[model samples]
Target: MDRYEGFREFVHGRQQALMRSAYLLTGDASQAEDLLQTVLMRTARHWHRLAGDGNPEAYVRRALINEHVSWRRRLRRRPETPTAHPPDRGRDRGDESLHRLALQEALMRLTPRQRAVLVLRYYEDRSVEETAALLGCSAGTVKSQTSHALGRLRVLAPELADLLNAVDPQEVPR
Candidate 1:
């Protein structure tokens, strides 16, 4: 087998899924592409070992999450100022797309850690323990972060209130 055959196949099969996670984590398409590329490059260096371990996807997922957090920290140290004008939403997208855009905006406003918890718990459908494990935090911390993140999301995008209810009625604070 070609030395890169396995790695190539793995990337082809999982790239889309990983990209979706990347986009969710970074909240920007270009940033997500960059994040995924950086993680994949790192993963490629360890592909032989990771492939033998039989769970490269998990490794890549963890790396993606960690790299995202690192990028957030570095950006915080030298944050860019936003323009006075918000980017136009571009014509009427109707309610569903508008809500999605609103949710994405609110998510971007959250702390990287909080956003990671929400993505793992809600988007990835991971359990509390799983999220905690991925986040290197206790289950209680995961639960609390989830609650706080949800509450913050409500404040950041009140229009998403009803959609948030659909996410987990018990979790969204009044």
Candidate 2:
């Protein structure tokens, strides 16, 4: 098959996983969608150059991380804007949703880079080396960020750490 066809297949196969990672990074569906679209567009533009690379997924993931970091930096440079509408006061769904909401809030409390490291390491199940490559940092940085992020999470929500550690593997062995 041609390089174009191969690149097409590669992108189609990895799109969903990329979107999930983007969602976890941004925490906003619309922003994630836009982020993924931008990444895909940039990837497609360089497909000819990247088609020969064995690790196209890694390249794409790195692009996503760089884009997210750059966007966050730009956002920080802007002045804080007032919201047109008041904060939502919707009723809680249930215990699970409430727990999830608390987790999301805690995630927001982390720095963007810390959140990215945690999501890539734990949520995406990436190794320190992989996350380091994606973030354009060293493996040591990934390890340190993961440790610090988890430490912060533990402080913010000790109950979550307890619940996570309390899972019994033998009860549901695959």
Winning candidate number (lDDT): 1
- Could you give candidate 2's per-residue lDDT for residues 90-114 as a string of tens digits? 8578988777777787887888899
In order of listing, the candidates' clash counts read 0, 0
How does candidate 1 fare on TM-score? 0.88
lDDT tens digits, residues 1-174, model 1? 555559999999999999999999998899999999999999998887898888888889889999999998898899798999988757458898888889998999999899989999999999989888877889999989988998899899999878777876665344
In model 2, where do residues sit more than 4 Å from their true spots? 1-4, 87-92, 163-174
**Which regions of candidate 1 fall more than 4 Å away from where they truly are?**
1-5, 81-91, 169-174
Model 1, residue 42: C-alpha shift (Å): 0.2
Top TM-score prediction, candidate number: 1
For model 1, how big is the CA root-mean-square deviation?
Answer: 2.5
Candidate 1 lDDT for residue 67: 99
TM-score of each: 0.88, 0.83
